[model samples]
Target: MLPFPSSSSSVMASSYPTRFCFNRECPDFNRHECYRPGWRLRNGDFADLCSRCASAYEQGKFCDIFHQRASGWRCCESCGKRIHCGCIVSASAFMLLDAGGIECLTCARKKVSVGPNFRPPPSFLYQSPIAEKFNDMSLDWSSSARSYRPPNLSGPSILQYNLHNRGDGYEFNQPTSRDKATAYSTEKQRGMNDLMGKLMSVNSNNHSSSILYNQKPGPNCKVPTCPNVNAYQPLISLKEGPLGTQRAFPVTTPIETNGHLGLDERYLWHKANSSPLSHLHNDLNSVAPLESKNLNFGIHLDTPGKYQVVPRYCPKVPYKNQVLQNLSNESVSVVTPLFEKILSVSDAGRVGRMVLPKKCAEAFLPQISQTDGVPLTVHDSTGKEWTFQFRFWFNNNSRMYFLEGVTPCIQSMQLQAGDTVIFSRVDPEKKLIMGFRKASVAQSSDQETGLNNNRESSTNGDAEPIDKHPPTEKKKSSMTTTRSKRQKVEKGDLSELKLTWEEAQGFILPPPNLTPSITTIEGIEFEEYEDAPVIGKPNTGLGSTYSANGRLSAEQDDEEAKDEAEGLLTSPKSTSKHPRHRNGCTCIVCIQSPSGASPKHGRRCSCTVCDTVRRRRETLLLRKKKQQIEIENKARKELESPNSDEELRQSANNSGTTSKNHEQRHAPPSKAQIDLNFQPERDEESLSPSNTTTKDKSPHHDETSCKPPSSSSVHSRHHHHKLHVDFADS
Candidate 1:
């Protein structure tokens, strides 16, 4: 097949002509080489694999994404995620992982990320059936089977032992060197057979086929943490057995817990032995957590490892429309040039930013904030370094910075009141800064950037430096506003506005123009009585308190989180069975018109009216446009079909050349008959329009050559009217 390419021949044909493989899964096909086909050789028997693989072999190199390395297999952990985006459509992306599989920044804490070299070994929690299987297997973590890399896992017991033994460095029992040499091949071949047998046996039970891989061992490996394992045990934690711990390693096999029962009974022609991913039999069963959606989500991101944690793809804050409403560069003194309201993380979420203690490198920080643009001095919990040059992640968003480190940065990172914040190691490779969080005894600015939510919003991991904050001179209103300005701000900025992504929810989304639709909320208008007592009622917290737009100021809203939380404002008690709100409207803002939505103004809804209306209008318009185009095209075709003598000649010529055999089978019409059929043009007057009469006089069809004007308005108008509907039905 390779021209029997000997080492000499291969050396001679060093630039061996390349060949392409059509199969996407072929190890030989390189994404780069596929884009270039001319250099691709097409020797029918040149090579079995694609040119890329051949080239790689010829050059002695391999793709980092697929080749086995010191770390582990690079195959997808979310193998079952090969499922298309929706039932009807496929997505452009596949579930890919980074180099250190299962490495992901914690969405709740910017500083806490999991991956090799980034976070420490992960843990797991065990549940029922998995625990039962685990109970049958050995549970040692300090042995060589775990501490060192394992050999091939061939048979069921061997594979189970390997799986339970290896996912997190748990070693399996290996034979002595002489014994290994004597039995390695036979045992390995036997193991390979066992691998095949186990793979085949999958789906025969509740276990899925993807998890039945070149597996190691023990059913407990599938469960993140086993309930049977004691929680306080330092060696194996049963409760917190998340991917962050060693328990996440599949002791037995990778389990597909996302509910795709590894069976393909849909097709009559599909073979019993066929697999969806590849002919090479390895199970990629779901190992996602049963409770958390993200723990084992099937988003195919191209990270480096076999166990890449799915990055959370939540709806973004509506940043495109998010205007910095409060600040404009007006004439102000230099004391504090009206610090522009760049961006703020209102609650426990962190903004990613970077700080340099020494040489500059990108740091992936979360819990961002708009600190003073000064290099921050940091000291590590180890009391190692001072003025911590930390990195924070930003949306690459704006120059203004804000950070709210709600949770500490590291598992080893802890804080206590009166302790000093410090910097430790700066992981440039992972774009992270490690340090200690110190607590405050005195009330620092009461407002804090909520750093509890550690979300990663940066698209490309091109790290950024955080404009340093001067920690010593703390501004009174740095968290929210410059405590001085009571001048008010835009109403929209008052509340934490969230955007919804219809794509994630499997709903077709509207364009950027989409905003919360207007809903009219009917306000109760009251008539004042003439003989009423002049005693003013206790303000009722309504008419006198409302702004012109009937919306509260940002200050009032801020008070709601603090004041109402303190039981200062008790929730109104409901009296009726169907509990009517005092204002008759079920909404919080009584003055709002029922038709306009309160969501755009910070209120939740109990209706789906707007979405339905929008979908209907969109569908109607799309249908209308499609119909209009079809009609116009049809009219143009009609206008060109052999309408004149020359057109007739051209048509006849084309028809003649089209099929000589058909002309002979069905005898051609007689000259007289054809002449009569088109005799309507015989009358010179009828053959030409009034405007073309002069050109038609010579019978040369002189008007035929001129281009038709786009301004055929009369005809266009007639065509348009005939094609399009004038109005939409309500």
Candidate 2:
């Protein structure tokens, strides 16, 4: 009833046919009810069943629905198990095709012996051991070398042009399991082993037999029968006498000719061509062999080698620079300068040879061994390395070590005399490195000329005249009007003319060229105004005077005044009012108050400004009291141990006081005391006599006056007494 025939058609068309459910647990087992036209049949079994019956089958859902289709299925021959069609793609993958039949990879691996003709499983195609492929070929040097065969390019390729070509054999194509293992082995491979064994067994007794066997012509090789060919056939062959012994030729001229010789060519050739026992004469000769000619070498001025000794000299003599005298590294450095010798004419003439100074060799060169050469490397300024050996020879008579091999190094660096060479050993294992600083050619020439000129001048007794007052040539010409120039009479130098300001001003002269004119010149001017004022002119605008721009000048002055006022407020004398404080610009107290009156005017106002002033005054008074206390303490200390000057003054004061008391007690009485009564005013004078003496002892400049000490002195003494009169006064 379906467009496509049922999968059971192929099974039913066979002689033996029975429809059954492919599913194991189908209830209608082996019955036609579960076997629909769409049901698949495989291996004489129904692989597909009806959906209703399939539900009852145990593995109905899990079974491969396409297993019964021939195109979608394959059977692994060795295992007798069905494989998906895709899994059986290549004959080499999981299966092998043999003369017997196809076999799975597992069966093939177990039953098959891998040989030169064997094909590996597909998985092992890339994993085959490298050693196995060449196992049959000779690898040992003796055998492989003798039997090694090069690929024959003239031979036929795998692509057969003619039908007779057997290129499809295992050598080119994938070999089959039925192919003999020895089929891929070459004759050369088998012969190589036999040849190696023969060579190993070949001794004096059978050596000739082995040689003759190796030289035998093969079927594949063409015959060449010349005497030389027979002697050297198979590459290394020997010719022998009739008795099968090597024949040796007589000693002749040496092989290397033209005055150069070592081994004799004829002797070696004959020795190789004949057996060792073969000799031209049967009896050994009694005469000894002649000695070889002594080799003679030609002398060369310069050898063409990696390094050569071409004596050369510098173009100019070297000069010592501050680098040597002051360079810190030079002082303690083991690697120092070579020598101070100037490049001589002889040294300069030779191209590559540089004659180093003897001192240079001793100072810089390391201790020499018996070889007398120390390897050294010179690192140039550009960082290229040139290697050389510092060879030194001991001069027994001179007792000095002379350095050699410096010539090549110097030539390579292109060093001249003035170019200083410095050596250093930055690495212990590495050779000493040499660095050179080329002297400035121009500077050196200039120095030489200067020396010559100095010498010539000294000889000629010539001296350059020195001007005591060198005239100063002005670079910039100051431009001014004729009037200003005429008026530019030099003001007397302030340092030379010590005069008062008025006297100096009086000495200034009026410009004679000055003339009042209403007209002005039409010229470029720096000032914005048409009429620019002179230097110190009074600025009429804003009633401000200016030396330059009036506004800037006025602002600067205001700022300065403000700063002064602030300073005064914080100064020691806070009571002293600043001139700018009354200006109303900087008085914050007055600016914020109700009355806004200046505190400097001495007017009392019931405002916060007045209150602030009162508080400031109180603080000022307290500070003053602290300062006064400090001053009093300082004075007490001074009075305790007075200086010589103060002690003298105090002694004079004491003497004067005693003299006055004596005179008062004796007869001299003042007019007021005389009138009061002759009774001495001792009681009144006694009460404060100590205070008077103390006051007199205080520092006073005017000691010449008869008047009592000044108020300052009295006040000083008052503080001093207050300190001493402690608890009693309290």
Candidate 3:
């Protein structure tokens, strides 16, 4: 702005300077220079660093070069190699230890490679200062307070230890309780102090010594005490050495101990009160043990004035942590079981409504004064949330609660009638959770039977049993009586007859050659047979032979009858071979009795065979009439044509000769003959006198002189003659 610049200088000034080195500790960090790429950052961009710093980073000495003076520095217990735990660069290079140190990744891998059966030396397992004090207190209590039976607690007391890292030291937030009484008297306190002095003296020689204590005790306490036992304070100070400058490391102790040990019970008091970051230590400890006994943090006295480490069951460091975590999550998700109901047909039906008990609805579901109700969100066992309408319907002067829109959930779980649905609520949020249980097949079947019985009893009042005997006895008696009656019937005992009406009627046929006399009885016409009534064999269409019971006994007989009937109806041999015969043949020769024992029916009889025969005759007569009319039409068309007189005379002579021959053959003209002769008379009337004279003078005047008839005319004549013969025979 102070001076005008050249084009090149202006362009150079507008461009940005080369990025500075990403390492803040580098000597050239603020210098303007070209940068080389270092490690990739979380946003996927390479860190801009000067050449020297980039080279050191690639060599894997970035943390050592830059963070050498960081506070989180610890020596590995196994390899004795120093590791920087303060920065993310070396975060994956080391693992935290349960006692109070860090282990290099190399040593950790080596320890894990030693396999599950490997047990660490007793020196490696060190008890924390707090745990050591408790151990001393437990020893004193066991010796002096043997008869001091504390309150019979229903469950283990949970001690909350909340560790948070602040500026130089860690802050422990422990929950304080006021109801607990002082655990020790003056003598007990003096004994605890002496025991602690001895423990400190024994652990002072170890370089990795760590101690934690509270600077302030409860308002009633008189001696130094651990933060969790008899008294609690807001802040617990951790002292690692004489100068008390070292930071306190997280140490996990066994949660369960012998209930007889008064002070040992404090170990079970710790809850899940630690920060999320502290869980990493727990995860490492639980995973390191594999199959060996857990690395418990406690000291045991093997001999006088000598302390050694002993392995104990640590609940937090066991392999069942994952299982316990899952159980805890489940417990949190479903806190209280509100109510359960077996699904009815309507509950699981397509209607998508579930009926809830009145008390459960009022107590568990939200209060609803309106019928429209409120939309409720419910979580299933699978953790999927679903929204449903919770409403009530007024019924029987009371209210009935119903949950609607549950069909999708029911279908997803594949639940049906007779399955049980459980309703539960989460604790803090009171979230509604729906769960289901499938009903066993046996139980469902029994319920169905009960429902059927109840319906029957409700519909019709209960009926008393006719027999006084027990059900089994009654069943046996009825079966035996039926068997005896059947035997009697088979032996032809008419008094013990047990037959259906159809079967009984089939056995009584009308007397042959005798007519029934009709009489009026109470305005009803009855047919009475004068001759003795004859009992005939039952007609099952199988055969005349009967069993001892006079009934068709074998299934084979019915099968044979069916096969025969099918063959008669469908077989080609059943059809008539005569050309004149039509379909649906009902001739006397074709009709047969079902049992082959009845006589042929007469023509006048009003039976199926007679009716069929009459229909056939009428059909044939109609066909003949049509044929005659057709012939007359042809003759008229011939007459209308301008044919020669000789041709006309020839046609007239042929017609007259044919008529005379038919009359001679059938002296008394039959119905078909009469019909044939009518067409000839019409032809005779159509011919004029000139045409007759021409015909007389023609050469074909004799009866056999006419030209040979056409094949169609011959067929017509033969059909007429056959019809005449059939009529005469009938």
Output the number of the TM-score-best candidate: 3
Error of 3 at 73 (Å): 42
Candidate 1 off by > 4 Å: 1-306, 313-431, 434-548, 551-730
Identify the superior model by TM-score, candidate 1 or candidate 3. 3
lDDT of 2 by residue, 188-238 (tens): 223323332332232223222222222221122222211111111111122
Give candidate 2's root-mean-square deviation (CA, Å). Answer: 47.2
Q: Could you estimate the TM-score for every candidate?
A: 0.18, 0.15, 0.19
Model 3: residue 39 alpha-carbon error in angstroms: 70
Candidate 3: tens digits of C-alpha lDDT, residues 1-730: 1110011111222233534455656765646355555543212234455678767766667767886754344566677676644332443355434232446656765664543222221111111111122232222322331111111110111011111111112221211211011222233334333432332242223211111121112233332223322211111112231122221212222111221112232222111232222332322111112221211110010000010011100101001101111354443221333445656556766789988765445434544545766676777767788877777898886679888898998887656544556554442233566665444322222221111223221233332111111123344433432322222122221111223334333333222333545433333333333221212223212111110011111222444433332222222222222111123333232233423234445568876555544544454365446445654755786778856555544443322223343222222223332221121221232222222212121111122321221111111111111110011100
Q: Candidate 2 regions off by >4 Å?
A: 1-341, 346-351, 369-371, 399-403, 417-420, 424-431, 437-440, 443-730
Model 2 steric clash total: 10
Candidate closer to the true structure by TM-score (higher is better), 2 or 3: 3
Worst 10 residues of 2 by lDDT: 297-306
TM-score of 3: 0.19
